[model samples]
Target: MTRLWNDPQEFVDEMVEGFVLANQGYVRRVRGGVTRSTASPEPEVSLVIGGGSGHYPAFAGLVGPGLAHGAAMGNLFASPSSTQVESVVRASDRGRGVLLSYGNYAGDVLNFTAAQDAVRADGIDCRTVLVTDDIFSAAPDSRATRRGIAGDLTVFKTAGAAAAAAYDLDDVERVAILTNDRTRSMGVAFTGCTLPGADEPLFSVPEGRMAIGLGIHGEPGIDETDIPSADGLAELFVEHLLADAEIPEGVDPATARVVPILNGLGSVKTEELFVVFRSLVKRLGERGVTLVDPQVGEFCTSFDMAGASLTLLWLDDELERLWTAPADTPAFRRGVVPTGAGVSASDAPSAAAAAAITDLDAEGQRDDAGADVPDSSAESRQTATRIAGLLRLVSDTVSENAAEWGRLDSVAGDGDHGIGMQRGATAALEAAESAERAGAGARTLLTRAAAAWADRAGGTSGALWGVILRSLASELSDETVPSAGDIVVGAVRGRDSVMSVGGAAVGDKTMIDALVPFTEALDAAVSGGASLADAWQDAADAAERGAESTTGLVARLGRAKTHGDRAAGSPDPGAVSFAALARAVANTLKNDTEEES
Candidate 1:
């Protein structure tokens, strides 16, 4: 449906009014709907950032605290007017100078350049920092001309912080340039957002597919692929970022840390955002990339659409400290600062430190504390190993099934569910294996593995999986022994988290149908004082039955919804898969415990 707006002009005006009103204390609307931070003054330098309006908390939301001094907000999915840019520059001008920073979009470039000239005529010193951080936006040789995405956060944050710290205009511009040099972003969209007064979406992609490198404002993407899991998506984005902004040749991938922004473009839930973040972090870790600081939320949006963008900012000492600095705004706020003895000079972990194998136990398992503990339990290790193996199997199965399922569902629905599920499963397996190999406790292994899986696997299913895993892990983390009762509790919490985040109840044709009963049965068995194996057996059996029951249940959410009555007679694949996984885990646990005894 088109947005309920009186007219395009009125819509833009009203939006600007609301934004300024909402942020009155920290920001003020200058000419052309641009917002400027009241805190910014005539310093050695001035910072200006702007872009289309749809991506909120972006061009404007960042105009406070240690961010942009001023922002030129454009019309919905359109660049701001040149006059607006000029007005913002005048408002932001300190006698010392101004730096115009904006994305590398044609409309933005034209307007911001004109605004720069206008400011120069006014006898104000002004410069520009164009952000071109999207690797897929253009060929490598043409990267300078590529459109900016979420990397704008880093560019502005660094520049704003430098300006706030009283850096000269040239120095501030240099900080912005340095941030861009170390930043890259990539995104994929499953659907497009509609402009405020438009009935149709800004862009379109076939159902069950994703448009990789799609511009935030409905610009055409590089290509469309069957939607991938959060982990797969993370891998895709990370690979591109790493390749485009090659980590220094001598740097250890693991010790190399960066800031990650898992951004939702409206319509995507917080749960999904977490899933993407988890995947991004895990993948980066495996590749020797450490996460120095992370901001996960809807920093930018494209109305109500299903999609996400990943932004990575490789930090030097200066940028990292600036990023870590305290800031407050309506949309974003830094938490309590660490009791630091001053910021560290080196952003990269030392080679000697990196060489040391920290966090491993005597059994060759990694611990959270990064210390090796001997005499770790063999039974726990075996259980972790089995779970890891099962996760791998699940990943392989999902991938194989996704291709087949995608083809089958292509007739009536987007076919990427199969692929999405498979990729998520694969990512989960990798995380599980890694945690287990690190000598994590059984509970820790399951919890971390689930988090890893959910993070990498992107869609609704990925979110669900993430919730389940996180709930389970949280419950199990504090337990020393983790009896069947503990497992039951963890499962119940997982089921609850899934329902809470997804808003789906049992019999909704979502994974909850299987997960709810599975956990309930496990709880009952545990409370009745059944053996761990017995409780697990009952839970697995209940899950299978629950999954089978979904065959007759009409789909309520997700791709199955489009199937209508046809979705009946086929068990929800998510439910079926959940049951299968539970059964495998139960069997493995039983066999392992018996062998140990």
Candidate 2:
């Protein structure tokens, strides 16, 4: 359904470039995403908000005075890598502390938390407030587990307003948490969204039917029913929202003041939203509820999804004030911006921020490029060349099997695993090739590949793969060729690193299922005096079995977990990809052994 694109792989980057070009007064391009182009005279707490790139106004469009200072844009429906998040944080930081906010997806949590820690280590005070407001994702008692939907606006707006008012880091975080606690949202879709270069939508409802409680990432809904009229849909929304269980604690629906946000997901027009809002307002008024600052339009979206979500933020005195505060972002504007809130375009300082960011990024790249290469033995240099070829094999295998991986992921997840793996592997291959041509040895080449995979791919798989390769690289030597024993130790380290970093166990229905078995089998074979190639074959077979076992298991972690048993009959795409990669490497090793014989 995404028709206009020069190259599917470059879609996000191109989209960001165009957004910056169009909104020069509001935002400027940074390494990761965009930051405010205009600087305030005094330092204030920076609110850095972001997630995947498809949710237009939810992120970059909200960067300006009285809103987010910057946004860390990720791939379509994927979380940004930690490197990307950190880059955005540094670019946005003033003397004041920083607050990071985003939807509470697993990948976002992992990446943002890592960035927070990284900045804190550099003496920058940083905090995180996750938006968990989609009522259908979790029960009232388990609200903290819910994923954020359109309610992201309520949290980000309140936090950004508090920061603009010169509130300290602690208060900004507090208000953000308070806003998230009061907000509740639900979404429905008449159809599904299709990713670029994909042949079909991620999931589809039957004709004349609608999917209820679907995620913004094109994930299938929890239930399907016949389409309802505008009034009926409004009633459905009001009934579910005003339910005693769904209402915020200590709030009386009959006497509450709420900010109602009627958000179009993507393809739905403003006219249709107004039609629904008309009935919705009447229903709320009849129940004695007072609505203030009702917003109706596209605030968050899934690319071309014919759906919408309703979000309600129960407002107290403080929250009401913050909610209605002035914000002059590209998409969201409220009241009149205070004078001196931002610098004028011709003020020289406006260009300084962009120039400073570009210089810092260039400096980092130069440091990496000019880092001294460690001396290597002749055997280790030859092994590095072979490793580069093996990386190319991985890239080819993942690219060839990407479609099947995407299909498997669509059963419950956002369906980007295949594309992510392909991007990471290709980037890793390119980095390895460049490092090899630079006369780098085994450890240095792998380190470069690891960083490239994480930086280019930007997701959960990308982060974990970077960890795996980095751990393996640590075990390799520039001075001598690595022995089978060293490889086994490295495999064990990679497994441990993945578990520690991803926080997934073997039965959690993640890539760990296959990775654990592969590492264990390789360790056993090597310990029993097997050759590296033969041991790798045994490990690959074990990984295949582990991946197959996931077909009967329910996901207990990550995005798929929200769908409960919907993923039970299909192998996790992550586990399947791990098995495939292991097998591909094994095949390459077998060929190498045959040629040597």
Candidate 3:
């Protein structure tokens, strides 16, 4: 349990601030995260790596001369928003292009890809290499879908080394991809971790049992067995890693040289890791595998998690050379890194804090207002005010049901859906209210709200909700009144766009399950000449049914997909939240009609 924190929401921010104060020699604070405090002799291809916070040393602690040029830090167990990613990329970009690398989680993929496209629009060359090294997240043939774990160091080291060597964007990307292909990791947990202010851990295992294939974000393991002795546990690791299906392609363990990293998740001590490493190294030697510079300590971590993971990087000549290259970072350091003609920390340029999506004053008053909004007509402004009211209602509804949604998500996910939805919905309402105060139109209000939701929420749901609203906003006109048919068309566009962006189908057990049925029912009702309120109520009812039906289905997408079986008896939190939002909107519409009558 995290005992020391002023506020749970402010934990990550405070941690970053303290980290920079302590390591000013290596890194400087930036808007989204940290960047190097010193400059290289000349611009090399910038290596920007990041993911959620709590995995310290992985992201911010790795930013320095020979590692990451910058890191885009997100909330606890959440991916950073696209706005955050863009900020770090802009600050890190020199004359050379930038290479974005991070774990292969759904939120990170959505946000990072969006940032890549945004920077490219400004004529900056940017590329991405997702770290997919967790062996248990997906089958060997489905490696692309696997999540990254402790093996992140191997890929980051290789890419950063290549960049430090003055490799172009193409070669840097190539080596990063090749490194990801050669790295494999597996993790086990003795107990789950608790987030700050949470009364319980995300998930728990029975006493004397150990979980296998657990994620770093407190996600419950996929399988469990009785805890084994140190030697027995090492045997388990060797047996699984040496299996033919688990080895990297073209690498024969009998004659291959590999770098083995034994990483402590959080609470596991260095002594325990050494104990495990002793048996692990002996087992590998028996099979004729040559171990390279073996590492045993914390690299990537889950806050307070009682667990560890082992990573292997199959080495060839080029990989071996890069793996041993001299580099210095706050966390991982190699042999002496030569001093370059780099600028000192005192002379380096500083960046202003990034504009927050959900801002607050020093006294904790809301500060998401005061932005200048777009122009609108009187009739459209009336609709915008009504939209603001509807958003307020939606925000309240989500807040009321957040705990239940979180419980559902914890069955198979990292259990932050409720927090994310709350953030997105609140930010959306704040943006809509601010837009309405400036006499904006419905389209302008929705557009602002959509951007805020995506930026504040910073997850798969956030990205999807932003897409839904932006698509709907595009169909509305500031000068004309919106009809029921127009709204239905917008909803259809939103639904289709979400399906395309998220790559999920109707039966994938995501929010699409509820969204599809609601859209279809609303369209059918509106086309039959029903009033907007009547049509919406009917659609909301259909959405409720759709959400309930997910309890019998298995998840085929997102974080839940890895533990699909565990999620079989529970409805997807995303689908449930969507249904709840639809019902809330329906109630607001119905109330407005009754008041008018």
Candidate 4:
């Protein structure tokens, strides 16, 4: 359990500040995360790596000369916003391009891709590498769907070392991909972890049982069984990893050198890791596998999860060379690294100005209020005012049912959905009200609301909501009043964007379940010549039915996907929230039409 923190929400920011202060010799504080304090001697590709907080030595601790050039830190178990990722990348990039790498989670994928596109617009060449090496997360054929775990160590090391060797952007990306292909990991947890200020852990195992294939973000595992002996656990890992088809094909276990990393998730003691590794070595030896430079410690971690994972990286010639290359960082180090004294700072000019965080971060994409807002007519401005009021209504509705939604999510997923919804809804309302006061049009007002919500929410749902609103905003014209047909088109665009980014269809037990039906009903009604208010009412009813359907479907994505049977009876929290929001918006439309009549 995490007992020390002022505010749970502010924990990541405070930790980043303190970490930079303590590692001033190695790194400097930046807006998104940390960058190397001392400049590198030669210009090399900046290796930017990041993910959610609670994983120590993974993100900020790895930023230095030979490892990551910068780290974009996020909130606990949530991906950093695109704003943060872009800020850190801008600060880290030198004349050479940048390589962004992280675990292949949904929020991280969306945020990092957004950052990549954002930086590319500024003429900086940037690429991305997603670590997908957890052996038990997905089947052999669906390797891309697997989550990253302790295997992150070898991939990062290979990429960082390749960058340190002054490899060009293409080669750096190639090696990182190669390393990802050769690594595999499997994890189990004896107990779950508690977020700071939370009274309970995200999910718990029975006293004598353990969860298998658990995620780093406190997600309950896919399966549970009675706890076994150290040897049994070691055998379990060996069986899964060695059986993986992706394990470097035709590599002779006798001649092939492997780097075995035994990573303790959090509360698991170092001694226990050593004990498990002891049995692990015997099993590997029996299989004629040669373990080289074996590491046993906490590489990546959950808050206080009593669990550990085993990762195996099969080494080839180039991989072996890069694996042994000189490296240095706050948490990880290899050969000797200079103290940055003799080397002139002119070698690497800093872009820290762009990376500086401010109170404006809370404003998110809304900071661009004066940037590219289209002109709006008086009639459109009136609609914007109505939209602001509707946003407030949605906020109130979400707040009223926040605790209930949270309780439902706790049964299968991390219990943050309700809080995340409340944060987004509240932020959206605030941004909309501000835009209304500023005489903004409907498009600008809703777009700013989307940005504010995504920034404050900070999760998978937050990013999706941003995409939805942005899509809808793009379809709206500020210069003219929108028609019922226009509303249907915008809503359809919003639904498609959510489905595309989230990769969850209607039955995936996500927000798409409600969103798709709502859009479908609206489109049908509009095509049949129904009024906007009447169509919205029908759409809201369809959304309610869609939300109810989720109670019979198992989740296929997000943290809840792995909680087999645990979430069987409850409707997905996302779908439920979307349905409620749809109803609230329907009421607003009805009220608006009545006023006009």
* Per-prediction CA RMSD (Å): 22.5, 2.6, 3.3, 3.4
lDDT tens digits, residue span 1-597, model 4:
788999665677799889988998888776667778877777889899998888997888888877788898877777877877877887788768999999988788988998899889868899998999987778888888788887888888989899888899999999999999899898999999887767778888999999998988888888888999998999998988887375677687767789999999999999988999999999999888898889999999987999999999999999989988888888888898654652255644444434333323534644334444557899889889878888889899988887778767777776777767777788788888877777789988888898888876777888898888888778776677788898888888888888887788978889998998899999999999899899999999999999999998988888777664678888999999999888988988888789999
TM-score of 3: 0.93
Query: What's model 3's lDDT at 130?
Result: 93
The model with the greatest lDDT is: 2
Clash totals for all models, in order? 21, 0, 0, 0
14-131: candidate 1 lDDT, tens digit per residue: 8878888887766776655544434333343667788667788787777766667678776555566555566666666556688888887644665577667756775668888888
- The models' CA-based lDDT, in order, is 0.67, 0.88, 0.86, 0.83
| Candidate 2 per-residue C-alpha lDDT over 172-265 given as tens digits, one digit per residue, 9 for 90 to 100 | 9999999999999999999899889999888888999999999999889998889999998899899888888988888888899999999999
TM-score of each: 0.55, 0.96, 0.93, 0.89
Model 1 TM-score is: 0.55
- Ranking the candidates on lDDT from highest down gives 2, 3, 4, 1
Candidate 2 residues lying further than 4 Å off, grouped into runs, are: 339-372
Q: Model 4 TM-score? A: 0.89
- Model 2 C-alpha lDDT versus the unseen true structure: 0.88
Model 3 residue 43 CA deviation (Å) reads 0.7
Identify the runs in model 1 with alpha carbons over 4 angstroms from their true place: 40-44, 244-252, 335-597
Q: Answer with 1 or 2, whichever has the higher lDDT.
A: 2
lDDT: worst 10-residue window of model 3: 357-366
lDDT at residue 304 of model 1 (Cα atoms): 69
For candidate 1, which ten residues in a row score worst on lDDT? 357-366
